[model samples]
Target: MHIKRVFDVVVVSLAAVVWLPAVAGGALLVLLTSGRPVFYRSNRLVGSGDPTKVVKFRTMVKNADRLVNRDTVPVTNTRFLNIAPDSPLYTRAGRLLERCGLTEIPQLVHVLSGKMTIVGNRPLPTNVMNALLDEYSYAGDRFLTAAGLTGPAQLVGRDALTDSERLRIEGAYCHAVLDGYRLRLDFSILLRTVLIVAHLKPSLSYTEVMDLIARNSGSRSVVALDEHASPRAADNTEVA
Candidate 1:
């Protein structure tokens, strides 16, 4: 923990050094194939006190967000689930990038710029962020630290679970950070993440995905949120 920043700089710098070519290649592919910007930036909550525009390879269409607003659904739902393999929004190259996780490669820029870390909670989409704060005041607090490209919850499941469950896992990860367990989990998280990527297969459904994550992360309470409860009181405050 004492060498946290040191570790971040050294590891990420080394990663950038080794992966520079891949990063450049990914960017060039996006530019050439999509004929648009090589990167995509969207506002997300880094933590309770930090808001940032997360940078990643532009995998979707140029105005994909405007066209589909696909970020609102839980990954298990129809918008993403029911999409045909030949959906026009995804280029042939883009589908490969998603499977290989290359689309996320540009986030290294954000990590290098100090807006994110090599490991921490993945940032939330804007609508998801608003929904989160509207339901759980303590949820946005998870973003108080630098956003992570991958973290405890991600090691558990990348695109699984409901919004409320994601919040619970995030909260648990934040608790681990506060309780000084980050160092203990850091290497394990990295190792598991590598394994997951290496074995990338079909998309896991939301429930199955979340269950795996909850189990792996050792979360004791990842219950569903109250249906009728309104968390808007938590929203008036600026998240950053």
Candidate 2:
């Protein structure tokens, strides 16, 4: 774990340095195109059992949250799916940001600041966290790690699965974490995410998610994730 954290710091630090220009350029585009804040930072719950803000490029209207039609779909889930190659809500520049995954560039800052890992469970919104704790407080152990900008659940099928299923995969990943697992998962996530962004068919399935957990069980026993964990934990922050 120590080594993986160190590796995360080093690799993400370098990414931030090399991509600083693009990050800035993207932020500029958001600012110019949306007439809103360039960066969208939201209060999220991460490991250490506390709240943190996750950052991303602002892709929706500034008042999106207030206007979110919960009757349609949860906002957090929509945020992930909205980036699908066809979502019509994305601003022109937002489409380009999503296409290249540049919207996530701001998370490199979080990696540098020790607030998050390059790869780990996605942070949940504070409301989501409260709901999870209320329902399955015993699973706090799973939430004891820093929130990640990416993770195993993401690698398999983030947008494809229902929120409950996504949290199940994350819970499995957390329990099975060991040396080299983070690196391997991060690499897999990056490759898969890039492929999805490129509009290629993703090789993903529920069976694949189970297979990853099985391969990495490593003395960790599998327990069912709380049914409500996914909806409650959906939320993000910039590097602080």
Candidate 3:
């Protein structure tokens, strides 16, 4: 894990240099296009017990949370079909950010702060985390490592995946980490992630990747965190 942390620090530092301008531009765009409070901060669980704030460019309207409740869809589900394109809760600027994937750039700060890593399990919303824990036995195992900006699941199909398929991939990743994490694996995942961002599809099917993870996972066992741990509330500040 020490090696992974060192890698994260070095990579994130370099990324900040390259992405700092983009981050600033994104922030300014959000302010002009959407209005004030250009950043949206949410509470996400990192490890089993660590709750950290994840920042993103504010893509939705200030009243979006109240206008639309994400809980309508069960947290364990991978698809968020309820949030349609025509939904009033979604802002024009937010849709563009989502399409270009610029909204997530702010999370580099979390990566630098050690609240997240360059590659690992994607962080879940507090409610989603709790729901998954209640539904799946393997949910806690994913938390054994820090949340990731990009990972196998993201490289696979992301929200296009079914709940079971998502959990399977996540379990495979957790198992791999517990058994043995290597710099090579991280580099491979990072490369694939870049391809994904560049609009290139992965050559391997999601099932193929899952099978690969299973074969490489070895026999390591991962323990889940306490189910009763309380989640922190995210502070939402609206700037006019």
**Top-TM-score structure, candidate number:** 3
lDDT rank, highest first? 3, 2, 1
* lDDT against true structure, model 1: 0.61
lDDT of 1 by residue, 1-240 (tens): 345555667777877765688788887887777777778888777766545678888777787777665353453321112334467888766887876767677787777777777777887666666655654566675675667888756654634544445555566555555544435455556666767777854334434433544444433443232223322333243232
Total clashes for model 1: 6
Candidate number that wins on TM-score, 1 or 3? 3
Expressed as tens digits, the lDDT of each residue in 34-130 for candidate 3 is 7989998877777788677788888888977655554764433333233655667667888877767677888888888888888888777677676
The TM-score of candidate 2 is 0.74
What Cα-based lDDT does every candidate model obtain?
0.61, 0.63, 0.68
Question: After aligning candidate 3 to the native by TM-score, how far in Å is the CA of 124 from where it should be?
Answer: 1.6
Between prediction 2 and prediction 3, the one with superior TM-score is 3
Ranking by TM-score: 3, 2, 1
What C-alpha lDDT does candidate 3 achieve relative to the native structure? 0.68
Cα lDDT tens digits, model 2, 75-187, are: 44332222355655667888788767677778888888888877778777666554445434343554656777777676665667654456566666676564224455556
By lDDT, the better pick of 2 and 3 is 3
